[model samples]
Target: MYNNKFYVVQDGEFVNPNTNHLFSNGLDPKDFIVNQDGERYNFVGFIFNSEKILISFPKHSFSSTDLEKLPQNSVMLNKYIRILFNCIKRTVNNRNDKYVGIRNELNSDYPFIDFLEVYKYYKRYGLFTNEKEIKKFGYAGRISWKDTMNKSPKIINNHNLLFLPLIIKENIEQHVFISKCMAYVIDSTLERFSLFLEGEKTNLHTRDIDFSNTSLVITQLKKVKRTLFKNIHQHLVDSLISFFEQEKTKGGNYQLKIYSFHLIWESMIKEYLRTKFYGLNDRLEIEWSDSARNNHFEKKVAYPDMRGMNGFSIEPDYYLILNNKRYIFDAKYYQKLTKLDYKQVAYYFLLKHFETNRDVNGNIINELETYNALILPTEYEIYSEVHFELNPEYNVNESKFVIMAYYLNTLKVMEHYTNAN
Candidate 1:
């Protein structure tokens, strides 16, 4: 947090819902923390309301809230935001085969808003018992036979806890409260993003639902838990709860724990390479091998047990062969590759020892290049790669990197991460 504010564009910063919420201050990234060692976070268009940290759907689509500092120009900011969006998407897609998702709408007609604003547009503002109409029953409630006898005036007066006229509509009370809470948030959302009249929110449902009560909305949403029906799915209820919690601060602080983002980064890098070399197998033909020459991209090398039945499948981050040369890629999310790292070496020797995959010469696959790289999401014009020399004296067997350590340009790959196959 910087200046006691998170580095994320607040909902209030957005002027309109169109243009995908870009070209507005609201989409500006802020309070971005990558690794465990949290540092100062300060950036324009990023001060927000969430006290802790969370992500919010400001522009209809969801994306990670973390971003590295870049040029202050709108053009740069907009591109970076797009990159972050694609990065998270790639990350999600990598973890799961497909995207099974759920989220509430950001703008336009809200579900609750349509019910009050457009659906009831024709109904004039009048007193009705629908909800929030505090109707009072003037006459007394039920009277028992003993009350008419007036045997004891005190006993008759204090019959049933002294009150029967008070009718607590428990069901409607929750709905009304929820609707009011939703309306308050919707109006606040419109106030920040849309150009509407002061009281022109909709056909005035009633003064009971405060049109401009952000404080009340936040307090109720964050503090007051509504008693929903038992029939409602817990997931749906949880989603609603999350929605309300997120709305507590329209300009919510999105925090990304970027430490464990290696898996996602690896996925992004793999996808990018796959796109670049789409028809790779057609160009390379070998006598014996698994589907690496066909359609299987992320193939694992499994060495059977003593029984040669089933053993753990040892797999590299990515493996592919082109032009009679094998390529092994490890998409690492670190500052730099270290000498201590030996996974790439293991992959190199494993491929060399594996008998199934070999060149036409009949020797172990000789053409092998491993790239262990750190991914940086910045505006680096060109990507450069350098080979890391290993010292042989350290260990007896581990010599020079059979699995070569290479520095890859990550920003360049992300450019095509979300591109078509």
Candidate 2:
């Protein structure tokens, strides 16, 4: 294959680099596969029977120059590109401690074009670190075919035929930090502007008092305002720094263990909205709820498997109310769906709809009409063409529910559902 595309699915699943499957059962290839669309591209077979392999492509095939232009509906491809950019950006910025392994894996001929595209994107962002930094770690520019025996930045923990996601965690964390910094700048700037105006208003109010009264009042007001703004700005900066510091030590564990990962995911969600949907952040509202406080309804409510409170409460990953429509989206870490997964999302929709009632202080007050939806990650871009309709009963309840499952690339379609449900 000169410039064809391929996908690497480990243990029949497509997930992050540090996922457990890459090293599960003590690093075995029996659980892994490289597929061309639905067809299998056996990496183990290539290793054992090198002569029999005739479909290998050069690593450079992944470059943007080699591959044809991506289709307009290339949802999955976008996600892969994001992942590659983040990983390489992590490595390039010196935020991540591992890069060589990810580079090696991407350089492999398995999914030559995808990997190359990822590398090209990474290079575009100035993420691929320089040789000076690489040599400082004494790597000798060689790829190690061993597990994480060394903590050296250049050393990659290789398994039977692949590297663990944790090894590349440094890269992930770096991008996450940059994301948090951007958020801090935005949030802090808004806060500072608000506080500054409040101070000005206070000063103007004090100026109207008697000469003596005004003098003292103005002085005190100035002190208070100065202190207040200083403290608030410092607090915002501290909060941002503290978040990244905590994420830094989160390590390779997923979910709560490496909890800062959510920051990155949420940031991605926000960035996606800004760039693609003309800044929908102002219109979108997302939150989580728990039933432990007996907020209402007969049944107990708690989201079993989501980002933070894993089984702690029925907090939906995203309970979005956009364009007056209610949507409930749950991010599934698992690639493929089992029967239970479907039922779980279905229950979420039912309960969410059930919760929106007159007895629970529902928001339907006088004029409340909206739709609900439950979406799964994109099975196909065409699936988006199918519009959803809301029942009249939900309008009476003044509550809507929707389940949308989506990958990063497909996030555009999901975000576009402001008027979808």
Candidate 3:
């Protein structure tokens, strides 16, 4: 907890949909305790003030009713005394060393190198190195450099609970710069970067983005995007391994080895929204059945990566619902989509099209809405590798075959809709 505020991670039942009230009784997420030997573990703490009882989990709740009872930093161990502002500020400021190590691991011309270039770009473009004479920021010298980063904006005056570190302006601006860079990674070379958004379709439906989700993904993407992005670079290097291919590389081919997964996934989702879902781009309108009797509006369908006790799962890398027709797709990262990949896609088709169903109270429903499977390849395939199994049990091969062409093809389709408007 920083400044008597706590970092709360809410996890439990008793979620109120109407009130948006998460259980008020749960513990804060970041509370930790130190052992006799100075080892730290989970120690939840909360501070109370007035009517608000900042209740944290396990132990430690503070009440402003007893303002004098709060623990001070002097009593707390240094390791356990993490002020959220100081920690994240330290992380961002000292990221150069971590990035240097990352760059050392990859070869030249790697798309990730370009990705890292964004950090440098932001520092330059955002004028982050230069200090401004702001009230909350350390430019006035009242607060420490680390504390300055956690400075909250003046307008968002909700200081009841612990606010995010740094001023809202700096935090958002910095994150937006990073988010734009991530978008560039998708737009530039590879047309995709592996990104895990918080929820499927929620942000898409709204005109504005949820900055919190973007912030979370940016931090996580730095860890995983490095490996996946390098795969694209490695493929380009290996593809030119043939002797004849070497002759065309005299001027040096720009090896854009960016994992196609990110771009392809982005394209598939965006296209599905534009072409199929139309204006309803925000929420995932999926129909699922996981009950004794299949029904459309029955049992609560699991979201996104839905897994069940029976080992039956619905993993839709890109889920498309047009009118009432369902198109389930799983993206494959490959230099070429082979017959084996087709079989894999065919399997998913069977899982989505045939086996998966909706359940009503005690019966099945929605036999009219057709479900189709799509094996969305990362890039263009020279020849159609699609094939159907002769199995009568799951007629997967009967579904239409679509190569998905390129990322632009989807964009083009979307543009057509926009232009028509």
Candidate 4:
């Protein structure tokens, strides 16, 4: 119960304990999950249950800077896991308003941690204010007749009543108890995030708040008496109820749930472009937006109504406006840009086909001048912009194939993503 497990594996590497099904809940976990290109991919995330395991599945590349290594818990391990977790949450919550709830599909479009959205909303718009009777002094409800003679004070006007000791009908102790209960849940989560930190750890949080028990947090929940008002309170009540119910049925003991870490890798790359690369004009200002942004980008390329090609659309990970030129960057999680990636080439042509402006006399903006690259993660530990031209021998003036592959250091991206957000 005390062991803070840690693990650090590349996208497709094999591990010792075989974490395909570490916990009995969720899906029957599998090692070597068939990933991009039908190859097995390792998924990683910090387990938020009783065991406190910190698993990290960085994509394609990671550094040996004494960090990463998700299976064994350590200060370094906690940090990498946190960075990945935060990245996923930010990436999801940025587009979603937290109230949108979790999306369910055969394959999740993005990483989703269970109840993270609800936790976000409840924490933001806390418990509802109670309806109560207010009194002038110490919440003494309803002025009494005996007080008129006993005190013999001037109580002629409403002003006099206002000056008396203020009191409330609802029990103050009950509210304080409830607030503490919610705080216990939040604070404990923060503390557990650092449970495995060794000598290299800092004070994540004291978690000083205490509550009677989890049941009180549930039982003490105030019920709304009216319909047409299933606001945040109602949503939270149902969510928390479902949470505890699933905790028992799923048998995860409220462990930290996570989707594939590649989702994080995609986010990390996007964050790097947004945060680290200064003066980098984000062509897509709504870049952090979730699937909707993907749709938005596709909308820009209006389909030609059953023309030569239809149906599928191009949604580049990033179509940045950097250094006064358009660049299409695809953040691929694979270790290397496999042999033939027609997708990037299609992305280039799709935009050119639809480019009304930013083009030369109805042509695709001088295809040679238009830039495109596959931004992949690398194990290199420094800030690098290593670019590899897909067709190195091709002449840009004639072939106009400005295709390239760029290797960005994973540690660099992680550090920047952690700090920028």
TM-score of each: 0.44, 0.29, 0.28, 0.62
Question: Candidate 3 residues 1-421, lDDT tens each?
Answer: 1333322321111222321233223322232323344422232222333222232221111122222332333343222223311222222233445334323322223333343343333334432221234344223224444544355443345655443443312322233232433333323322221111011111212224333354453454454344434554333223212111221221212221111123323333333333333221212222222221311221112323344455554444554444555544444322223354453354344444343346765344653243323333221221122233234445664444332322222223322323321
Q: Using TM-score as the measure, name the better of candidate 2 and candidate 4.
A: 4
Candidate 1 vs candidate 3: the lDDT winner is 1
TM-score of candidate 1 to 2 decimals: 0.44
Query: What is candidate 1's local distance difference test score?
Result: 0.39
- Summarize candidate 1's per-residue lDDT along 104-133 as a digit string, tens digits: 111111222222332132234321122333
What's the TM for model 2?
A: 0.29
- Model 3 poorest ten-residue lDDT run: 193-202
Cα error of candidate 2 at position 133, Å: 30
> Which parts of model 4 are misplaced by more than 4 Å?
1-10, 17-29, 34-41, 47-54, 61-73, 96-131, 134-184, 187-232, 249-257, 278-312, 321-324, 356-368, 382-397
In order, candidate lDDTs are 0.39, 0.31, 0.31, 0.48
Best by lDDT: 4
Over 108-199, each residue of candidate 4 has an lDDT whose tens digit, in order, gives: 32112334534465456653344444323344555544443444344547454432333323333223333343444444444444443211
lDDT for residue 209 in candidate 4, whole number 0-100: 36
- Candidate 1 segments exceeding 4 Å error: 1-71, 93-242, 245-257, 278-296, 299-301, 304-313, 321-325, 355-402
lDDT accuracy of residue 232 in candidate 1: 28
For model 2, the local distance difference test gives 0.31
Q: Write the per-residue lDDT of candidate 2 for residues 317-347, one digit (tens) a residue.
A: 4443434444444444323444345544454
